[model samples]
Target chain A: MRRVVITGQGTINALGRNVAETLQAMRDGRCGIGDLEFQDVERLSIRIGAQIKGYEPEDSFNRQQIALYDRFTQFTLLAAREAIGQSGLSFSGELATRSGVILGTSGGGMNTLDENYRSVYADGKNRVHPFVVPKLMNNAAASHVSMEWNLKGPSFTVASACASSNHAMGQAMQMIRTGMADVMITGGSEAMLCFGGIKAWEGLRVMSKDACRPFSANRNGMVQGEGAAVFVFEDYERARTRGADILAEVVGFSMTSDAADIVMPSKQGASRAIAGAMQDARLNPEDVAYVNAHGTGTTANDKTECAAVADAFGHHADDLMISSTKSMHGHLIGGTGAVELLACIMALREGVIAPTIGYEEPDPECALDVVPNVARDVKVNAVLSNAFAFGGLNAVLALRAA
Target chain B: MSDSIKDRVIAILAEQAMLEPGDVSMDQSLEDLGIDSLGLVESIFAIEEAFDVSVPFNANDPTEGDFDISSVKAIIEAVTGLVATQAA
Candidate 1:
């Protein structure tokens, strides 16, 4: 099987608008969760989220584009542009035909849905926009990315709740490994901080009002976050021949189903996925030095994830470092795993592990070394990114330095 | 009016707890009634819709929220207070 490697990455998240700015924020250990700024935010019981602060669509796209693209699609296109631009590849002939796009998102055009619903139900409008259905479809972002980049190969979107991004990226990697595509522009995006979005999630009661303190005894719950992250996954040999700047190698990926609970997590399922990724990558437990945890700061997720890690790695669990960048970026839901993979890439290439910021107190249940409150500078050869969704869907990816 | 409010609160709690209103006890805590955290939130929503009064409850830190949800009796009293304040 051919190897897959990441050639370029870009993101517009709560942490930053691009790869450099985001890595810098991680290094500084900044808190991006704050009072959300959007229409009807005052009406929400939970008033804070890690929202993109000063983005203006007019500055990035034309008026026609803005009318057709939802907030999630806009974010995806922006990140995709940056990633493809950085990769320095212009698609024209067979290269274009041999490339595709796969993205993950739970709320495809939530902003459009919320607005149209408001206009019809709240404002009593007789007619809605004709583009509403096209804009609001779940595969809109993936289709748009493929169209923009001229990719004709396998193109689709994956929506497995919180594990969406990881599942999408894993599929992208497999496509390149099996020679289905030489390159794939893959990642995830989410724009669910609107009134309807927050209202729907509020019903779940798994959100924090103040902060996301993952693994902290004083932690309340996960905070909702919005934005997107995109990457260019290319064949390793192709990237090497073209002298592309390889960021990290996609060494392994594995996904599993709990078949246990719909909303609650299962440790056995999570551990098996983790173990399965390492086995696929042909890496020993000792080879992994860091883990980007799926720590959502909820009362149920943190301890359960720690137990899963313990079961997966046995004695090596205590030696490796695991931290949740979600504490800083908040939980981006479907797009979260994509952004957290940046942390894994950073740890492998830059040797700076992002901290689980807002970590106030430690819990014995989560006894691992959760590089708390501050970023750690340590060299790491390999790392794992874990994403466990609400429906007991778990996906883990193993990465190594390029 | 207060009696009506109490009856509505009891009905909502009973619905969330999956018990008949006759089977519910005023002194029983939400947990004792087998209403988990999500059920408690749903009960709060029912109360708000029935009375058109917002309950200042944040599920992240339920105990610290201003809305009292300790027991059926306590929830009824809190909803009554919110209704009165909104009316005023």
Candidate 2:
């Protein structure tokens, strides 16, 4: 089997607009979550979210381009441009034919949907935008990304709620390993910080009005966030032959379903994914030095995740560092795992463990070393990123230092 | 007045456990009655709704919760105490 390596990474999240800025924000433990300023903010119960404030669409896209690009699609194109630029690969011939774009997004075009809905219902307009269907499709981001970069192979989108990105990347890695593609543009993007998005989540009673304090005892719930993170995954041999700058190695991935509940997380199911990733990577429990947890700060998620970690790693659970950057970036939902992978890459590349900010009190149930409150400078060999979404779907990705 | 809290809580627990109310002993833990984490949380929600009182039961650390649930008896006692306090 061929080995897959990440050659480039880029992001435009509430934390920052690029990899460097995002990593710096993580190191500083800055909270990007704040008051969400959008239309009809006063009508919602939860007005706070991690929004990319002051973003001008015109700055990135022209008027004609903006008409077709939804907020989520715009995020995808911006992140993809940076990632492909860093990858230094101008695809043509077989590379272009084999390479493809696979992205994860729950809300493909929330801004578009909300706008069209208001135009038709609230404003009493008879007709809405003609391209509403194309703009609002879940695969719009992936399709535009492929068209923009000329990636003509195996392009698609994954929509397993929060686990979407990890699942999408896992599939991309497998395609490369199986010699289907030498290069893949893979990751996820989400822009759900809108009135309709928040209004829908308000019914679930899971949105936090003020903050996201994952793994903290006093944590209320997860706060919504909007952004995208895209990566360049290439075959290790090709990258090495071309003398490319490898960021990290994608070693293992596994996904599992609880088959028990729709909303509440399952400890056994989560444990299986974690243990399965280690097994697939041919790694012992001790080989993992860090974990980017799916710690959503909700009592059900935090406790269930900690229990799953303990069950999978046993004694090592006490020693290995684990943290939830959701505390800082808020929960990006479908795009969360893609952005959280940045924390893992930084950990392996720079030996910096991003902290779970806003941790005021500790609960024994979540007794792992969460690297709370501040970043830590520690050498890490291998790390795991956990994405446990609603509906009991869990995906775990394991990566090693390049 | 507080005596009714125990019966109501036990009934809620029995429903969650999918067992008869009379079969729910005060000594049996929720786990002993086959009540999983989901059941426990749902039971808490139901109890809170039925009693019209907030139960400080942390799903993360049930043992350390403000409302006790060591056993069916403890949960009943906790609810009775809460009801008495609310009445006062």
Candidate 3:
């Protein structure tokens, strides 16, 4: 199998708009969870979320494009443009046909659904926008990215709840490893921080209204975050031949299912995915220096994930550095794993560990040394990114320094 | 009115458990009613919306929560007190 590597990365989330700004925000341990600005905010029992501030879509897209693009699609395209721009790849004939786009987004066009539903239910509108169907489809973002880049290869979206992005990237890696695609624009996006989105999640009662403090004993619950992170994955040999600046090497990936419960996380399932990722990479437990923990701040996820890490790494778990960037950026749902993967790249390339910010009191069940509140400056060679979704679907990706 | 509150709570729990009100015993634990964690959380949301009073139950550590869920009777008592406090 051929090696796959990340050539470029870009993101627009609660923390920052792009990779540089996001890396700086992570290094500074900034909290992006705050008051959400949208229609009918008071109706939601869970009011606050990690909504992107100062985002003016009109500045990026024109009137026609805005009407055709939903918020999720817009986020994906914007992040994709940034990633493609950084990669300096101009897709044309064979290259364009060989490359593809795969983005993960749970609520593909949630805002569109909210607005169209409001029009009929609340405003009593007889007719809705004709482009509503095109605007709201799950594959809209992937299609747009493929069209914009002129990619004729496999392009689709992955919807696996919170693990969507990791699943998408994993598939893209396989496509490249097997010579199915020379380059793939893969990542995830979400724009579910709307009234309907929060209202639906509020019913589950897993949301925290105030803060997102992962692994903290007094942590109320996970706060919803929305945004997108796109990365350009290319064949390692091709990237090296082209003299491209490699971000990090995608060494291994593994996905597992719990088959136990729907919402409740399984320690054994998560452990299997974690251990499987290292085995796929052909790396020993000690070789992994850092882990971008899934750490959703919910009680079930935090405790179960900690136990899984213990089971996976055994004694190595004690000294291993793990932090959930969700503490700062909040949980991005389907797109979360993609954004968290940025932390892995940063750790492996920059030798700086993003802290699990907003940490206070630690629980005995979560005994791992959670890098709390402050980013650590240390040399790290390899990193692991973990994504455990609601339905016990766990996906882990292992990366090495470029 | 207190009996009505208890009945409404029972009805919500019943709806979640997919059982009849007669089948749901106030003395039975949530587990005995076949209400798992998700069911319990949904029941809390339904109760909150029905009464317009926020329940202090935490999904993370239910033991530390001020609202009790030991049994149907306990949930009823907790909801009744919360409703009473809201009314006052």
Candidate 4:
């Protein structure tokens, strides 16, 4: 199998619009959750969310493109544009055909669906918007990204709830490793901050009323967020020959199914994913310096994930610096894994572990270090990002310094 | 009839449609308040349930102008009229 390495990374979240701004916010331990001002809701206890501010479609796409794309698709396009731009990879001729795009999203175009539903059901309107179908589809984000960059190989979207992006990136890595594609643009995007979207999540009753406080004793639940993060992955030899700036090497990736409860997390499933990823990377637990946990600030998730880490790493679990960037960015749901993967890459490259902000009082059940509320300078040779989604899906990716 | 009722109605309207209370006035058309046709329908539905009154709409006419259903006061008036008519 060919070796895959990350050449570029891009992200747009509540923290910032690009990778640098986001990384700075993470290092500074800024919590992006606040009173959601996007839509008015009646006495909603769940008022805080990590909403992307100051985003305009005109800044990223043309008028025609904007008409066909939903907010999630627009976000994916923006992140992909930044990743491509940073990679300096020209999508021309054979390269375009040899490249692919894979994206992940759970609640795709929910805002569009909510608006149109209101228009049709409540207003008794027969006419729907011309772009509603294209805007509401799950594949729309990947389709938009592919069309924007003219990628022809193996383009599709993965929907594994929160693990969506990890599944997408893992598949993209497999494609490159198996020589199916020389390069792939892969990531996830989520824009479920609309009125109806929040209402739907409110029914789940797992969202926090305040800021996300992962691993904290006072943690209530996950705070919903919206954003997109994408990475440009290419074969190491091709990247080196092209003099591409290697961000990090995709050392390992593993996916597992708990086959257990739908909403309740499984420690065994998460442990298997971590063990499998470590095996795939040919690295022992001692080699890992940091772990970007799938800590969603929920009581069940933090405890279960900490147990999984302990099961996978044994004594090394205490030594490894574990943190959840979700504490600052809120939970991006589908896009979270990709964004957290970028955190891992940044940690491995910059030798700085981003903190799990909002962690005040640690829960005894979740006794990991969690790098609470403050960024730490560490020599990270290898970093692991874990993403556990609903429906028993779990994905883990290991990244090494290039 | 009371200030509290008015405030509650206004708060619900603002929350449901993401509008400011100031945007909804006594004489302004609901449509003009950025309450789309669906929003108008939902608001009417919510108001009817809230006040326990039936709001009559001409089934044949479904336009923004048709929904002259203006302010909270106008809504209360329509509901009261509908209730009186039903009683008669």
Each prediction's Cα lDDT score?
0.92, 0.91, 0.92, 0.85
Comparing 2 with 3 on lDDT, the higher-scoring candidate is: 3
Per candidate, chain B TM-score?
Answer: 0.93, 0.88, 0.94, 0.61
Candidate 1 global TM-score: 0.94
Provide the clash count, candidate 1. 0
Off by over 4 Å in 1: B1-6, B26-34, B56-60, B66-88
- Give each model a TM-score: 0.94, 0.85, 0.97, 0.82
lDDT of 2 by residue, B1-88 (tens): 3557778888999888889999999899988989986687788778767877666654544554478777999889888777667657
What would you estimate as the lDDT of candidate 2?
A: 0.91
Number of the predicted model whose TM-score against the real structure is largest: 3
Per-residue C-alpha lDDT of model 3 across residues A79-189, encoded as one tens digit per residue: 888899999999998998999998888889999999999999999999999999999998999999998889999999999999999999999999999999999999999
Per-residue C-alpha lDDT of model 1 across residues A5-101, encoded as one tens digit per residue: 9998989998899989998999999988999988888888888999999989999999999999999999999999989999998888999999999
- Tell me the lDDT of model 2 at A274: 100
Query: Interface RMSD (C-alpha) of each candidate?
Result: 2.0, 4.8, 1.6, 18.6
- For residues A115-234, what per-residue lDDT tens digits would candidate 2 score against the true structure? 999999999999987888999999999999898888999999999999999999999999999999989999999999889999988655566766888888888778888999999999
In angstroms, how far off is B2's CA in candidate 1? 6.0
Stretches of candidate 2 off by over 4 Å are: B1-88
State the DockQ of every prediction. Answer: 0.45, 0.13, 0.63, 0.02
